[model samples]
Target: MGTFDAEGVYHPRPVVADDLDEATLEDAVVRSIVDFDDGDIVEGTVVKIDRDEVLLDIGFKSEGVIPARELSIRNDVDPYEVVSLGDRIEALVLQKEDKEGRLVLSKKRAQYERAWGTIEKIKEANGVVKGPVIEVVKGGLIVDIGLRGFLPASLVELRRVRELQPYVGRVIEAKIIELDRNRNNVVLSRRAWLEETQREQRGDFLANLKPGERRRGVVSSVVNFGAFVDLGGMDGLIHVSELSWKHVDHPSSVVQVGDEVEVEVLDVDLEKERISLSLKNTQVDPWQEFANTHHVGELVYGRITKLVPFGAFVQVGDGIEGLVHISEMAVHHVDLPEQVVQPGEELWVKIIDIDLQRRRISLSIKQAAEGGDVSAEYRDAFGEHAYDEQGNYIGYDYSTAEFTPETEAQAAWADYQPEVEGTTTADEGQSAEPSDD
Candidate 1:
């Protein structure tokens, strides 16, 4: 062997057989280093992290370089956030060697390849994918499910959620509705998952519900005919007619959306998935209460509310009315009811009849006024002309007498007479008609 000094002088040295073999072995080891092609996935340890790139040691001749953009699927990420020194991770080979002779690698690409296989298997098994909401975009949201999954706004909930901002950072489970490998697109629907879950719950709710049972629920919506109430598992309808004992013009008059109310189950149709509820049945009936305390021939004060050809209706109490037939309005041959009574007129009446089963009451104003004095002024003015118990004239008459003070009174009475066909004087049975003058 020969050696060179620092002064560039050649010197002779002793040669060993082991030294000659070591030189030959080093050359063979260098030639035997493994070669890797583009797109190969390799495991490595993060050796360095910088602002723009990361260095990974994958047992290669040189450390692999992963640019900042290739570190994660997220955009504008800092290398420090995606990886740390000495952390084991998998990377995809982007290039065997770049122009600078450094191996180019991508951590995000390796994750994408692994995620595609996992998602396919989940879909085949009809499994659910859970992830956190990452971004809110136009018409939808982006969920991080190993990769970015698009969840449309309409399919986010059972009903469309108006505010998508609140969903950000929330973990949710969804079903895969669409998948395209070539386009790298995935569509998810949370509504489908919810509907399926609710259907099972509804079946159990319907089985346990029975007629005449009371329940508490929230009013979900009001329609012209009824209001729909949410009973936790399903929605039941409260018809307008069943809202109150009194007549209701519309369902909104009794209940509005989000009102909490107690209701009774009136009926249920399992085949059709329908439930009928009654809000009034849970309260007291005013008509039944009035009937329990009132009876026939009892005097009550009321106001005339409506008039028809048959009779007049008077409201004696709240939601309680009694009809007075025209024949009962007065003790005379009355041609019309309005001649004696008018709408909005308040008066006293006696209940003549009651039909509790039919919910009817008959009243009479004339009968209630019976046995009262005719007129106090008329009695004082005609004291001289007395009448018997039958109301017949019994006093003496002076048709052709002299003009005395008493004689003048008798002459004035001779000219007056009653208009009845047979009676020449007012009869006790005859009812007095109010004078027009």
Candidate 2:
């Protein structure tokens, strides 16, 4: 029996137990039980996995129930795929006690909360975030950067990538371009990261690049003015004029997108971050080659490329054209070049003057027709004479010559010649002559 002493309260009997340790054990159990509230993040060990839910023992009064949908940011995933039994994981308390008196937890929200803090720090530091592409949505992809992050298709690469399915399951690095915690929206750009990396690479590339240095590249894009080539680090422009040794009407005519080409560095503007490239400069100069093998006073066959006010450009070699002045088109003073020779007409022409230094060659159709040795003035000036096998006077007959199909096919100036004397000409125009400089 026991008696109450202090306040004159009634006494209750105390039973004497075989062991007093049970009372201490019950007190220890009460102290071991942890208390949690909604939105609290708690760590636990996965105790069991089920078809639609997972059971985690967070040392609460009851095991915490995590629905499969709340297990991961990825939708329609199996709970087993997200967590395994005995694995330690952190979860957010969704409900201290659900309708069934069970503790409810969400693994995804906990990860999301932690991710936001980390991402904010990364964004401030201008660091890159990497994650796997989990879903392919319209206009973009969903990357698992702790939470779903949108990566637009246009900002996925340096160039727009039409096919986004290939990106699924691939891990990629990106910069956080936008962040909205209230809306739970995050926008990412892989291109930004790539461009930043390329900027550094471009600096190094530009520093080492020298004019006239040959380099290999891939044609990235072709525009009206020029084609842009990716020279490993930066893009250099190949102007339409420098695309070919022959005259080029358009950059696409010489190189197409995705074409691998060898190019010469014509100029490097570090201040402007511009590079001038020449595709034709990397190849042999047709004019130089023709000058080496051909000579003044010799007769060569050519097609009338264009009939200008002053002259007709005649193509005698690949990428090489000589001007036949209107005065030299015929023995009789010619008012128009088309009257004596029409564009697209194959003809023989005599080279009367060659300025190798200037890359200009003066040709004569009338002189080629005249039955005479090289002219006295030309012979006296250049000291070369045009003679036949019997040493008789022989001049080329320009009117009777025909071009081989292969030659006509390869000629760049075979398209549309400029009109002469109000008549529409059907041959291609001559390309602008190479700069003497």
Number of the top TM-score candidate: 2
Model 2 ranges with Cα > 4 A deviation: 1-23, 371-437
In model 1, residue pairs whose N, Cα or C atoms come closer than 3 Å (at least 3 residues apart or on different chains), thus clashing, are: none
Give a tens-digit lDDT track for model 1, residues 1-437.
23446653435456455544435877755764556789999988787788999988777787899999998877788999889766889999999899999999999999999988999998888889999998898999999888889999999998778999999989999999898989999999999988887888888899899999999999998999999999887999999989998878988888999999999999988887899999999988777876776666555567899988877999877778989999888767677778877899777566788887887889987754432222222234344445557443443333437323343323333223232344422335543332221
Each candidate structure's count of clashing pairs: 0, 4
Q: Estimate each model's TM-score.
A: 0.70, 0.80
* Residues 1-437 of candidate 2: C-alpha lDDT, one tens digit per residue: 22435653424357566554546877766876887779999998777788999988787777899999999999999887888766889999999988889899999999999999999999899999999999999899999999999999999999989889999999999999999999999999999999998888888889999998999999999999999999987899998888987878888778888999999999999988999999988788887888777778775677888889998999888778899999987656678777777889886577899887888999987666443343232233221222455432332222335532233322222221121334322112222121111
List pairs with backbone clashes in candidate 2: 348-398, 416-427, 416-428, 417-427
Computed on alpha carbons, the lDDT of every model, listed in order, comes to 0.77, 0.78
Q: Model 1: how far is 339 from its true place, Å?
A: 6.1
Alpha-carbon RMSD, candidate 1: 13.8
Query: Global CA lDDT of candidate 2, please?
Result: 0.78
Residue 269 in model 1: lDDT: 88
